[model samples]
Target: MSAAGVDSAPFVRLTAVTKRFGRAPPALDGIEGIVRGGRITGLVGPDGAGKTTLIRLMTGLMLPDEGTVEVLGYDTRRQPAAIQAAVGYMPQRFGLYEDLSVQENLELYADLRGLAKGERDRTFAELLQFTDLARFTTRLAGKLSGGMKQKLGLACALLRKPQLLLLDEPGVGVDPISRRDLWRMVENLTEEGIGVIWSTAYLEEAEACDHVFLLNQGRLLFSGPPREMTARVEDRVFRLSGTDGRRRHRLARLLEREGVVDGVIQGEAIRLVMKPGVTPPLGEDESVASSRTAATPPRFEDAFIDMLGGGPGGRSKLAETQRSFAVGDGKPVIEARGLTKRFGDFTAAADITFDIPRGEIFGLLGPNGAGKSTTFKMLCGLLKPSAGEGRVAGFDLRRDAPEARNRLGYMAQKFSLYGDLSVIQNLNFFAGVYGLSGITKRERIELMKEIFDFRPILDLSAKDLPLGLKQRLALACAVLHEPEVLFLDEPTSGVDPITRREFWTHINGLVEKGVTVLVTTHFMDEAEYCDRISLIYRGRSIALGSPDEMKSRIVREDLPDPTMEDAFIALIGASEAEEAA
Candidate 1:
């Protein structure tokens, strides 16, 4: 039956759909919704909120245990092929061939969609320009940076110009600038009357959608325009700033304990949502300000946090113990002297020299394809340097890579955990492989379960776990043996803001325990958490120092007090302009 008696039928419909594995509750429990045409509808929720499952169901990837799904008036179960041919679905990890060039990938997809040779050429050309990959048509997809890879994925999905597009977290791991570009593409699609159902955990991105579906544990909490949902909770928010930075976390904890604030940490400040009829203590004498005084209405993020029953900021207590090292003293954990890595005529990393102090939290900050990953791979012994020398924990990077590998734990940018294995099974496998045995391994496994609060999902398959839990489990496995130094490449990419905070807490804890950290991240705010950072551009280290020092050095005389983001833009802009000249 058509929904709400609208003359134009809904584009997509799900009625009482349920998907279950084993005896556990359904991954998607009796879900129902209607996606209208020519609008951008966001699916907003935390990990395991059934966003992916719904998308898969709609795209005919899996059969629902019960209920029915309809797309464009075609029943999904009976007419999946027809639905698949009419819709564009881009999964979280797109299926792009590394060996294929940009234009080749698009042409392949166009061919798969059964376009004729002439039509394929015309569509591919248009998509190349639309995705901004025209200049790099010959470049291998694997060689493209994270942001570029995402654009290519979108382009592949758009080859057919289907009436509907399903994007599953398409902006994950992309920088702010690249994200804006990607969104502009989506906006253009909607302008052309192509309906979209985009599932994402990033609330800021969700706010931009025409309508939003708030899901929790396989249940729909609300579905409507973002403004309507936000308006309901607008009066409850409060902006807070404190003189004691250290006390910010403590204060958030206290407010949470008092049951007054549903808050999140936004940089140095906390944005809180006050409970109904519960007044927050602003100051002893001054009048308590209304939510309006907080500057703007509460955002979708604010509403989502309130729905979760509010708590202390996403801070984890499972960090390693604290032990401070002198700022510039002691043997460097990693020392690179004129290190270089090249591929034919291209230099991936060029003449890089730096020393990362032991027990320090060091960061590599740069845009995608700035040689950060190349430098990281070289340091971790995954890739050999073409020239110069480097040491990891006093072991030569080139000559003693095996020895260096043993002393370091490295987490790649992608999800590396085995999906088919149970959480505990994965933990046990890594522990045993790392050489922990018998009672010791058992004890450590139990400790990990407790540390990550994995008891709830310990028996659940890792592949079936949500993104946030999977990330936590991955971190647990990486640190199981407690290596002396760790390398994290975009560890928090794609995680929600709360989970990102929790991940950092764990990282900070590792540093406190004298485990030197070398991490690469796209979130500029994360750079603030590092003791010192190295900014790379075009295969070279362009800037290196403490966050304050880098900021002071890069900002123009006229623009004084430039933020880290501003500093990064200015530094990269100046260097790129110089290189072009």
Candidate 2:
């Protein structure tokens, strides 16, 4: 059911809603939207696109400063309790007890919903089967992977079998397989007349929704089916390809030319988008000119990029830094030999081994709690390896731990920025900790502000900034001392596609200048940027190869045009099959 014929009433409706905090500009201004029953409405936008604010208004957590907000035919301000009782909300950072077992958590939520014993038992069994968590019912919530935790949170939210469900970035930081499982669950709910309003920074997720409300800078840009939006750039997208090892340089050149709306290296080719009423540039590089390219249908992200303005004007350029640590001539900059980590009798990472050469982007791909973090911590010298050893920039991880740490930079999964401090203060403090002072520190701070476009939010507390701005702040602090190696743990997990592309642009520039990057990401599309990847499953590196190599190795006759996500799922599925056998 769409907004067209919904019994003269929407499940929830917002009319010219406006909200503000303090003296700052309105967080949401004059927004109009509706959520219909038995449909998935995606609140899609970038970091500070007012998605969360809209959700709060719908749930009656906050009253709009202007206009009216109603849910289930009741005014949010007067009937907040009634609305709250009927809607199920799962926040970005869900409230789940770390120490509580999955079964216990379910019981707690069931009790909160005041369910009888019979109802509780029925609900628990249904949820367990739906979420595929029956085998792990006794496992603590904290011990589950990021995806499992999300499923558990969803199960708890469904204890009351709400009429409407609201999920805020539930797929953030979750692996592809887990994301698929969660979506399937949501799809099942919609069939039961459970309206779902999910907010996401991911464009792909927004594409799957029945309707999309594109919000940006507190304003609604468009509201309709995703195809209606993507249709704007239908025949404008093209794929250009050439000889191997030259795609990046060709992509950089294409982006520099005028009329080129957006260009990215997709697999072995460059996906190009042209501005409206504009043709592909003539007399360009041979790789672009002589290539036999054809127009393809635009993806949701392609239209999103065009809608935001057809150019890469807001991206940051690579910063100038001293290259004192020379790349080991033909030798690996990072080496892991039989690395292992164990907690009690359970091994988090067992006998994992990989060698990363200088200037290469090495990705550690896996589901959450699959030992990617454990192996990362050991490699970075934060946790001692239970067995074997590794080397970082020529420093032995187990021997010269301090030296190893100093030679590299580490960005945690959740940014480690000082939330209480202003952006400038955080940069200054990180610089000081890195031993820079006086003129050197000032210059470094200024450079970071310029590169990351942080001047606008300089005085804002780190916690108050949007997700993209916070990402920039965290990256600036990480590279302050210009370490030879950088470790990014799920850096672009929750960010929008444009922000992620911009982040990788800077990273690519750095790699060209001899910086080695070790990254862990849930976005399979990002695997294309890495020179090589290791797919980890159950504390083991099951597959190690380049993106193309791995995808090609998956001998699945069923899947044509196999992608990184397909390859990853295939490998994990195979591993599970072998273990069962």
TM-score per candidate, chains pooled: 0.81, 0.94
- Which candidate gets the maximum TM-score versus the true structure? 2
lDDT of 2 by residue, 1-581 (tens): 53333444588888999999989788899998888888889999988889999998999999999999999888999999999899899988998998999999999888887778988888899999999999999999998888999999999989888988999989898899999999899988887778899999888888889999998888998999999999999889987655434565566667777788887766676778898776666455565666657787788888988998864632336533545445558889999999999899999999999999988899999988789889988999889999988999889998899888887888889878999999999999999887888998898899888888889889999998878888978998988888889999999878877778788777776776678999999988788888899999999999998888888887566875687888999899999999999
lDDT winner among the candidates? 2
All candidates' lDDT scores?
0.78, 0.85
Q: After the best TM-score superposition of candidate 2, give how far the Cα of residue 247 lies from its true spot, in angstroms.
A: 3.6
Candidate 2: 10-residue stretch with minimal lDDT? 313-322
Model 2 misplacement above 4 A: 1-9, 243-246, 277-283, 286-292, 311-316, 320-328, 555-558
**Cα deviation of 334 in candidate 2 (Å)?**
1.1
Question: Clashing residue pairs, candidate 1?
Answer: 319-509, 320-509
How far out, in Å, is residue 142 in model 1? 3.1
Model 1: per-residue Cα lDDT at residue 262: 57
